[model samples]
Target: MNTIGSWQNHAISLGLPPNTPVKKQIDEFIRRWDNFR
Candidate 1:
């Protein structure tokens, strides 16, 4: 899955809205994953 999709999944797993400001947390997670890659 793409970053945005994976982010959405992370947010959903956390019971957050897909577009919630907390989605920033998901974006951070994606950033970390990208950095690791």
Candidate 2:
């Protein structure tokens, strides 16, 4: 998804790998947010 790509871009900008824990946590939060809607 475009939104996910943008989030990953944030990781790239931070000089971290694509699969960082911070990204994982953000993805989980997004999943919960979509469910909450």
Best candidate, lDDT = 1
How close to the true structure is residue 27 of candidate 2, measured as C-alpha lDDT?
A: 77
Per-residue alpha-carbon lDDT of candidate 2 for residues 8-36, written as tens digits (9 for 90 to 100):
66556545576567757577667767999
Looking at candidate 2, the ten consecutive residues that score lowest on lDDT are 1-10
Over 4 Å off, model 1: 1-21
Q: What is the lDDT of residue 16 in candidate 1?
A: 65
In candidate 1 the C-alpha lDDT for residue 28 amounts to 67
Query: Cα RMSDs of all predictions?
Result: 5.3, 6.2
Q: Which residue window of length 10 is worst by lDDT in model 1? A: 1-10
The per-model lDDT (C-alpha) reads 0.66, 0.63
